[model samples]
Target: MPFYRFDHAPDPVEKAGFSPEEVPRAITAIGADLVAGMGLKEMGVHFHRKAQLIFTLRGIVRCEADDGVWIVPPRCAVWIPGGMPHSAALSGAVEIYCLFVDPDAAPALPAGCCTVAVSPLLEQLLRHAAHMPVMYDEDGPDGRIATVLLDQLARAPVEQLNFPMPQDPRLRRIAAALMADPADRATIEAWGKRMAAAPRTLTRALTRETGLSFGRWRQQLHILIALQRLDQGAAVQSVAQELGYESAGAFVTMFRKALGKPPARYLAERRRQDGNGAD
Candidate 1:
């Protein structure tokens, strides 16, 4: 099934007796055991009411919020802000390792949810953390591991997969419509007529809400849809046609411009990177 909306799950922290503040050190201590216990199909959510860093050791996990959705593949992690309602859906089976960081450790990270590329050292550290017990003594190996994990987390590279929120109701309405059918080729005037707003008003809303013109926003939406499809193993040509592009060449051009690489190249690089690591 297509994942289009954010679904709330029951709070697992309360049941597990784990607080967000302690999740980082806790996970660093019990990293391996947690991965072995929670199979990929088992969905989990931590209301990390404190800014937290979650690492994905294997497989892909999809995160959805009111603003956008993120596909966190192997060797990539997500930084989720405290109190942001987000849920994850794992793809197939996964090792699913994670580390939660205390807010004080990384104050500069985004308060909202975003994905980051994990380094090989960080991946190894998190995998090692899975074996330790939660709340382990700070003086023990787990405590030392936790300290290194925090250092690595601070240096992880942030990927550009963010979709900012559209605050204007008028622009939001247009965004929702575009998301519903990414292939829509409606002109600004046509969309304005459908929304019962003047074309100028719609233009202003697009610029204000998303910092992108209608053309740019549409392109971004198309690229996002393409990424989702590619992750599912959709053929490039088929995906292009499905997205209303004239040809695969046209789609590749747009994707390269948006992501700085062609789809096949991007996939190959990610696959190669995954093969070399804990993923």
Candidate 2:
């Protein structure tokens, strides 16, 4: 697996440049050389010429785009549209299965960054795609695999695992503080006072910038960081407390609410799809 490293990015030491001529007419999968749990300290925001699926094969990878940051666990993929600047981090041991698809070749792929849920069938298809030669026959078995993959990707559920970051300086300050310590469950009024901004002003900035109210925005941050910690093998109770949850059950409820499953159940399923249980 070879990962393209681009020189345009000051970080993510690994990069490569590709043009449409460099890729297949449809989808091309490159077994990216991502190590388990190793991340580029900082990969300056960059984009791909082709829409990319940063699919996690093992462990977790966290990525940040212009709009938000997402923690991608096993069997989870971050779908980034072509030309969308984004950067990624490997919080823990993480392996990547990269798929680059031309929108002209597969119109069903989303034009924005999204967290895609990988079904069992889709995962297998992606596995096959990863092993495909750079120039696979479009009219052959690989072509059929690519076709099914597009359908699966198009039909895959869009999961709410991303936390959109606010761009306003004041809001960024507030967001930064909360992300530093999700357990700091302070009131908006209190936070505003600490930041020397009016509560009303803070609320307006948060809503206008991120389209998320102050409270919802904080919860979103909590979700993003909590997933990172949990994926690193933290105990549920500890993670709950770390994120300001009253108990493990409270954290589980929130996790289920946002992602439709508790940490244990989710990780179990991840492991099952991760080739530990079955192919």
Candidate 3:
């Protein structure tokens, strides 16, 4: 669903613990574990005064903001800047940690929505921060921990998990249709006919709005879906077939080409990292 209205309520920190602004500290970390079948599945469009880092050790969290959708897989976090309207959806069983930081607390952090790699130390910091008092002393050891957390977060390497969404209404329709049925292996010409536009016009408009060609953009969506599905424990063959790939090998080739690793290796590496620090 597209973001329509801005939600004027407390930030998501309230679900895990306390609200971010109620505390006098620069950051507030809270953790929540959501299992499948829970009544909660999506968060409405919302914005807050503090920036947020949505990190997950298990399952997946997808956030939409800044005209793009970002997926937080294992060992990564999606960073949403302060006052940027956004919404999030959770899949499967999710153990997520959200850290809300004052806008001015970390000058080095990215000022936009992006996914960043979470190191073992950074993951532990967030996990530990969740247990900290809402009003941690700025001059004490907890304060020092907060300083380290911010430092690590600032230096966290960004990942390429952002799927830019086109703003044009026609392009948005195409995007929505493709996301709804990823297995639809239609060409640009076919999509153009479906959208009542010339293939060249669709191509040019998509490239102009998203900086990616039609094929690349479609493949990007496939990659994002593949990542989310793999993270959810779907088998490679099933995921490949589900995405309309002729065979699992074809899907592996595409995944390896796009992500620099095959599905099994990529997921294994992430699970290794998680096992190293995950409780």
Identify the candidate with maximal lDDT: 3
lDDT of 2 at 58: 54
Instruction: Choose 1 or 3, whichever is better by lDDT.
Output: 3
TM-score of 1: 0.75
Candidate 1 regions off by >4 Å? 1-47, 54-75, 85-98
Ranking by TM-score: 3, 2, 1
Count steric clashes of candidate 3.
0
lDDT tens per residue, model 3, 15-104? 334457556688888777777767548898998888989888777678899998886766788999999999988877788888989987
- Candidate closest to the true structure, highest TM-score: 3
Give residue 132's lDDT in candidate 3 (0 to 100). Answer: 74
Q: Whole-model Cα lDDT per candidate?
A: 0.66, 0.74, 0.83
Extract clashing residue pairs from model 1: 24-100, 29-132, 30-130, 31-129, 31-130, 32-130, 32-131, 33-130
Clashes of 1: 8
Kindly list the per-residue Cα lDDT of model 2 for residues 1-279, writing each as its tens digit: 235431133334223434433675688775544454454445667777788888876565778885787777556789988888888766445556777888687776777788888888887787777666556788999888888889889999888677777777777776667766779988999988898989999888778877888777777777777766776788999998898888899889888887788888877777666564246
Model 2 stretches with alpha carbons more than 4 Å out: 1-21, 33-41, 269-277
